[model samples]
Target: MRTPPPRVLTVAGSDSGGGAGIQADLKTMLALGTHGMSVVTAVTAQNSLGVQGAWPLPAEAVRAQFRSVVDDIGVDAVKTGMLASAELVETVAALLDEVTAPVVVDPVGISKHGDALLAASARDAVRTKLLPAATVATPNLDEVAWLTGVQVASETGLRRAADAILSYGPRWALIKGGHLEGDAVDLLTDGSEEHWLRAPRHDNRHTHGTGCTLASAIAAGLAKGCSVPEAVRAAKTYVTGAIAAGFALGAGIGPVDHGWASPCRQPKVSPSGV
Candidate 1:
């Protein structure tokens, strides 16, 4: 009866666990008042204990799924995660090049339990192909080290990390400093302007989907026409609440609460408001 909301798409693996990957991305989009779509790049046999196994889809299949949504339904923004191989990375990056939507590239390399998601061989493709096409590249401390070889020990290294990330060609870089010793701090910069986002470090361990959720939330905000800094700030607020409310799922590290921003379903405000 009314116009559809801004459409956001996640191109990532399927987490059978439902705490991360495509599941978390879609949940975050809905929580942020955006329509969610998916283009699965891989499938993981996983649970809270750990990832048991993973299998990447054919590159053509990834391409087709992306086209199926983009050609007919269209999209306002896109987020990418857990691309398993160099081929898939290049494929998704190429698809990103063809679209005008703002892209949030989460260079997802490892799982919460230390399982490798992106192949080591694929790192090069992600840096040259994927990162170059992103509107904002979101990488945690560990991811930043592997992708940029710059190990950040404290808050001071955040600016250095952002510089390394921006050299990859993203319009903006969000260097997630969650692993730092003190308060959870992050650095966002576009070489000229900078926004240092900090939040109290919530003492919670069930943060399995933090990367995917934050990146997707940023995408959702961008879809609603927020600027890069605006989208990232709002995403930080949402994820901070999520981490604080995280609950135990299985015998191991659990997941952040994607619906933490919404206690219960409230009446829609506007098509663009979350």
Candidate 2:
């Protein structure tokens, strides 16, 4: 008999540019050896430039998609991003209540091109409804400020931000501090112990999908049977490599190379060790 692949699902928006959101999530999952599935909550006319327009799907449609996937195919882990509205957030949260897998929540508030994806009205829904259901909540610096009113200027400030996010009831909080100067550092905590993740800054402009990609990668790790901290550590390493191997495609910021493994951009080694 053939072995089954680890299954992972991404609940997010569709990016026309295919560099972020659902596109990036799926790419990351495939590269990390998992079967990727999606339930798109919104569609956006986006590119490396910016978001031109957006249309959010109805709550019924969102709920139906979640049921279709969860009831049959059965996900091992689920990652959510870009819900766009409070109604959609609540709907997803309620649907998640029925899912048995671990949940990775990337509170996608703004895009790499500086377009707002989640609305100001929906912040409360994300905080009260969606976040509490998360196995781990991944939020970048801007989103940290948006959700908790705390600014992470230095590495030490990540604790305060993590505490505020933990108050929402997620088992773990992964606060991404890539926006800070010098090294790209992230903080992971469970309201008690703290894990400070530090990596050398790649100085790459093609980091368009870092948040979504990292969350999805972590979900993929969980689906493959890794613990939360182990998954996070692996994801951080993977994303750093992706960023280091990133390429410029469009006129604006491109995306981190999800296919950082298996000789996509880098040269492949032969059996002869050449």
Candidate 3:
């Protein structure tokens, strides 16, 4: 009999376009050699063009899915995205506190095509409830501004952004500086220690699922037992390749290639922590 791989669970919305959200997380997990599981928090009428409609699941429904997965199969790590509303955010946050595994929270605020994935009322829930339960909280530039009122205009502002996010109580704060010019840089810190992850910017415009893909990749790494800095560095490497290999899909922006690193056996990450 074959040995089962490490299990990783994603609690996020589903993208009908098969690009971001639950779809991206599963794809990334499989590519990274982990068993992927999911608890879909919502379903979106999304395409490469944009998110047309989104309906969040009830708090009870979300709870049932999480319980079903963790109760039987068990999980080595968990990642969250696009909780949609305050009820769902609070619900998932409460659920996470009971788990023994590490949690990666991608405080998804907006879609690639400028659609809001999180409600304004839910922002408080993310900062207070959701973030406090996370092992690592991954937030992009725009998310930094809206979540903590820290407007990061250049690379120099990433530290301030990380500091603001760390105050919310996550064990580690990964401030994605992907929206900045020049290099694609990110800051990973846990108050005392820091690691600056930098990759050459890919000139690909079809990089739609960047945030979800990166956060999920980080969770996959954690499931496989990589330390916070190690997991994040490897995830950054994986996402950089994905962005570089992004292909044109529909008339609008497309998704990062979640499978792009598989062929090279490139992720080759070292196992370390939760």
What TM-score would each prediction reach against the true structure?
Answer: 0.95, 0.96, 0.95
Candidate 1: stretches off by over 4 Å: 264-274
Q: Kindly give the stretch of ten consecutive residues in candidate 1 with the minimal lDDT sum.
A: 265-274
Candidate 2: list runs displaced more than 4 Å: 267-274
List, residue by residue over 1-274, the lDDT tens digit for candidate 2: 9787999999999999888899999999999999999999999999888999999999999988888988889999999999999999999999999888999999999998889999899999999999999999999989989999998888879899999999998999999999898788899999888888888877578888888999999999999999999999999988888887777888988888888665547513221123
lDDT of each: 0.91, 0.91, 0.92
lDDT of 2 at 82: 97
Backbone clashes for every candidate come to: 0, 0, 1
Candidate 2: C-alpha lDDT: 0.91
lDDT of 1 by residue, 20-130 (tens): 999999999999999999999999999999999999999999999999999999999999999999999999998998999999999999998889999999989999999
In model 2, what are the clashing residue pairs, if there are any? none
Candidate 3 local lDDT, residue 110? 97
lDDT per residue for candidate 3 within 1-274, as digits (tens), equals: 9999999999999999999999999999998999999999999999999999999999899999999999999999999999999999999999998999999999999999999999999989999999999999999999999999999989899999999999999999999998898878899999899999888776679898899999999999999899999999999888887887787899999898887756564322311100
